[model samples]
Target chain A: MSDQNKSLDPRIARLELPQGESIVKPDEYWGTFEVFLQEKRGKFHQHVGSVHAPEQEMALVFAKEQYARRGKCVNMWVVKTTDIFAFQLADEDMFATTPDKQHREAGMYKVRDRIQEYQNRQK
Target chain B: MYGGGFLPEENPKKQTETVAEDPALLADFQARIDRGEKIEPHDWMPAMYRKQLIRMIEQHAHSEIIGALPEGTWITRAPGFRRKMALIAKVQDEIGHGHLLYTAAETLGKPREQMINDLLSGKSKYSNVFNYPAITWADVTVIGFLIDAAAIVNQLANSKGSYGPYCRALERICAEEAFHLKQGHDAFVYLATGTPQQHEMLQAAVNRWYKPIIHFFGPSDKESVHSEQLMRWKVKMASNDDMRNQFLDMYVPKVREVGIDFPDPNLKKDPETGKWNFSDPDWDEFYEVINGNGPCNAERLAVRKWAEQKGRWVRQALATPYTKSTVPLA
Candidate 1:
């Protein structure tokens, strides 16, 4: 037994570890599961965080432990991290706008003034 | 819970213009801030604003990860299954907060790996409170309740800051911290109202932690410098002294109601100013601790370094190129 382990609280020290060392394999990794939490009923699920698990069922259990232990979450979905696609930062320019688009805003119109003018003419 | 007031080093004379920007664009940016518009990642902002925000967010993220280590050690020895489960969940939430803050900081153009390297190299700073050890289980309650309360006071204000990603991150973090406060208060109440031994343990822990709790808000506003521009940009939401006073007003009565006493004999409220007044907590010691001389600074960093080194293989393996899998749900 290592000296550090001996100094740990007996409760933790007694927890068994798997026997023998395991070799790391290339191109293999613990699956990363992305967690989405639904805050309440009728609410859309939002991405919360991720956890590593060996299988989908294990991912769900781990997600519950990591993200949904609180009563705030009513539902949760766990998907592999690799499954999600995203736009690179370089593509941010595509979201830009050119020229003015004030016509799309309510403040751009003077409808209230025009309505008052029509009302006066009607009177 | 660890995102408390951060006092960057005094650099009042430091130049704010390294990368020159157009004067008209700068005026428009300041006008947008005056109108309370949030600055998104792609927005045109001064170089200094981006640098300060990155520094603040990175520090906060580091604080969360290191903050978890103290209470995390007590999980296995939490005395009961209920406490054990709660402690584990709380620590996990703190780690999650760190990841969220890292993502928010990454939006400012620094990679997460570079931030971690800065933390490992001691080029950045986290909350000084984590440098002290959680010696007893009762210390966990003190930290969870009192320290978390201090952080909420700071974070609630920062949630309204002018940075979109950081403010959004703080909004979610504040919500989770509220739950942690409840758990901490519940555990504290149990001990304070329990047997004589339990009460004694609780009191001792409180006394031991009182100084660090007071230090949690950083230096007094009068002694702080290089914060005026940051506050104007909304990178720093509130003054240090204001957050500390707010924390004391909200919590002092509760602690007294529990029949516990703070170590400071001069601790009281000023009726005229509606502010907290207490003896100085030795700013020299605060400086020393933040300079990496505190009791557990070395230990905390060593553990983090070990985790990073051991997990390198896992991170590398995960980075390997693989075909994206689509699993069907029944």
Candidate 2:
């Protein structure tokens, strides 16, 4: 489990209500679904927005209306908000790194200058 | 899609208050605009630019939310499951657009809550077209198709504006609106070509909405104020009359093709100049409606107030301090 999930309140982390439980509203329990859309065949699905739906079919239908109504998408995927794990804001520093990675950039190589020098010599 | 015609400020003095910037800085700013560089959120802007952008974008955000109410009423009453789902989603998209626009406007220094409060108190004005009511199901189609089409004309132009965030927001909104236009046109066609009763309903709706549609673009350029500087700043992308004429050129033929007659006897295009000439929709009534005396003005505000009140608990609940027991993701 992720560190963020590990730190979640035990009451919520351990809580799993039965299907159709009325204590907490379905919207609150069934929760949101994150939508991803692929604009056309073979394209990567892009994260769009979330929708509230109790089931997958309903979620897809809602996704179609919310994300694909303009024919901007040919395919979509909806995952339960709970099923998706994300790094916590507290863990954002994990992405921080030294800015000295010039070796990975094209500007660091000077390939164009070297090629021009070679072409001048060949001429 | 709905923002057209700048609303006059309630206090002219507040609008004219110019904070003195260094002449060089002002010239540099204007020079950057002349060079076609977008002014980012953190960029230095003249006080007037900030105020006018806030006013224009906040009014647009307000228009989105208020505009939702008229067609939102028809969600449950839509003819079928297909129409019901589409209406609900369309209205939801409108509310989402409002959220996006409010965020864009917030970048100009006004809080969304303050902007909405201004809307509720009538300190801020939405599009005047929404001030009129959507009286029938046919009205919904007319609004969705023609009104949205008009808004597209305006929005497409605004998308080319110099404000970075508002332009970006309009780009996405215009894309979504393309589908709304299609659905609207489909529904309108179904009713227009259906039974004679359906056709009559649609014709009446077209007649009822034609004046408001004309009014949607606001007053002519000849009567408008303060547009010259706005155009130079790229804040007002197109003149109201120009957008109205463009809308007519694109949609009037399609509307006529569907067999619905516009109420205006003089709504004909001048082939010589490619301008639309029509009897002026009653400007007096337009002024009165914009000043808060339209048929559905009070009703629209009341409904918005009710939604605000009813949604307060949910907002409050969401605002509650996160507890150790709370699962942030869920």
Candidate 3:
């Protein structure tokens, strides 16, 4: 119930997925495609989606082909999917959840008024 | 039996070996799951759970990142200005989806940098579909109609997953994806009903995509070692086979109605079982493609690496503390 104290830090060092035998060869396919999009030409291009492509040239080609086709874009960007970072959900309760209630939500001190009233009466 | 990557580890080798031995703790984990409470970022969790979630979330994130490739290519070449604008919006929506997913994954304790680093270093994995080259303008429609359709099926299911953050992200993403599916379908219908060349183009695109679309389900349920564990933990809302069946039921008639024929000669609907059946996907190729050996793998990776290299300056500039005096004039 008291999850308020947990904070998100987007700048932490990344985790590495152990590399195994890659499905695609280094020469055959571009590693991965990373995509970002701009709602309009002047707006910031935010990261959106990724795909595996053969090269930067190809990724850009693929990005333009795969992501910007239907009708709602002014500009688009693509990179390698391998270059981005991500997180896990299984530990959602651990790194973000806390046990003590005193620090989480402000509502934990619901009886502050009552305590102050009792002290005033005694005085 | 295996380990390493993402979060920093002292021994790296011993990281995977780190496991909670207490049965009580395991029970507590199960109890938490039962409470319908979101597992926050800083609570005790099993190592395997952490590993699995990282793998799954990273891949999902990667898929979002790469999935934007094909459509982005079509923006400049869209047959009309309206189509171009619509395509651009659709691409932006995908970017929004990535943000939602990255935020969701962050709630699980890993830093966004670490996740991105893993991807850059080739220590993380994403979906296999992006590795295929998009060869034609028609391929754009195919990707939108068929690829996004497959993704929507999966994302809709993911919307109900046990993880609160993932569920929320899926909720928003699925909404946008519905529009994407329609746009693609609309494109497909237009092309299918257009001139003979357009119809032929649609048909050829369908043939090109059918195998990849079917393969998008990942390995079949029978061969997937992690499917059972993921289901047990509610990480996976539906089995692979169930999702495949759902995709088939929704699309087979739709494909026919659009006047595009499904490529599988063996594809058939079993009235007795009320399920569609077809030749099995080549699991070996599926595994190979996902592992990073698809036709366009190297090309894709190189593009990413180069972009990252080029963007280093931008990233570094952003990382520098902002001072009002040094602010550049817009």
Give the number of the best model, judged by DockQ: 1
Docking band of candidate 3: incorrect
- With candidate 3 superimposed using the best TM-score fit, by how many Å does residue B86's alpha carbon deviate from the native? 1.4
lDDT of 1: 0.78
Work out the TM-score per prediction. Answer: 0.77, 0.74, 0.67
The TM-score of the first chain in every model comes to 0.70, 0.62, 0.45
Q: Candidate 1 chain B, which ten residues in sequence have the lowest lDDT sum? A: B321-330
Q: Distance from true position, residue B22, model 2, in Å?
A: 2.1
DockQ, per model, reads 0.10, 0.04, 0.03
State interface RMSD in Å for all models: 9.7, 19.0, 20.4
User: Model 1 off-target regions past 4 Å?
Assistant: A1-123, B3-5, B10-21, B223-225, B322-330
> Which residue pairs collide, candidate 2?
none
Q: What's the candidate order when arranged by decreasing DockQ?
A: 1, 2, 3
TM-score of 3: 0.67
**lDDT of model 2 at residue B98?**
84
